[model samples]
Target: MLQLGGYFKLIELGLEDCVSDIDAQPVYGYALYKDGKGAKLFYPLEKFNSDVSGRSFHNGRFIQKMREKAVTLPNVRLEQGTVTSLVEEKGTVKGVQYKTKSGEEKFPMALWQY
Candidate 1:
């Protein structure tokens, strides 16, 4: 998954530092079990190159890092809320409708167009 373009895009967005330490406790591999016995052991290092083999990390930490990096950008805005639905126009997603602690809000995509 780390070999995908989206991961590189994050690096391009100035998140290279965050990527290195995204997880507090990194998982390099995993084992599968059946009938209380180890069925198979899988390790990225054994199967793929170091560059493409990605480690598993805490998802919460990943989100935190992404939010932290996004806030530093001038054009980004972070909102805390539940996304009720997507606001689409024609066939494209044009915006989002969400509910915050205070009230419901609609954010138009045009506001962020560059």
Candidate 2:
């Protein structure tokens, strides 16, 4: 049930539209640890392959698409503020407390927190 809900959220977050291609090939490479001190890796979103990679979309592209879709939703409102804390009760999140330019505000997220 939780997995299904997560799939729906991905759709709501515009995962389909953000993905420019679904058949992109994977870039074959591995992380190299130089002298057992530093490591380097070059994995870009465009080089992702669903057949090989665990993640479907590149994180940055996914985030950009979600933000674009969020603005079009009637129920979802974009808030410009720094989140101070999350309200929780009985180990469940109930709301989010954030500070805006005008004042501090509390927005209920009980329906989605679980």
Candidate number with greatest TM-score: 1
lDDT of 1 by residue, 31-92 (tens): 68788888654443555445533445666777787789789889888777777787777988
| Per-residue C-alpha lDDT of model 2 across residues 1-114, encoded as one tens digit per residue | 113234445456556444444332334334576666766564443653343332344566656666777788777767677777888899987777777878867564443633
**What is the lDDT for 55 in model 1?**
41
Worst 10 residues of 1 by lDDT: 1-10
User: Which regions of candidate 1 fall more than 4 Å away from where they truly are?
Assistant: 4-13, 20-53, 107-112
Off by over 4 Å in 2: 1-15, 21-57, 101-114
The pairs that clash in candidate 1 are none
RMSD of each: 5.0, 8.4
Q: How close is candidate 2 to the true structure, as a TM-score?
A: 0.45
- CA error at residue 76 for candidate 1, angstroms: 1.9
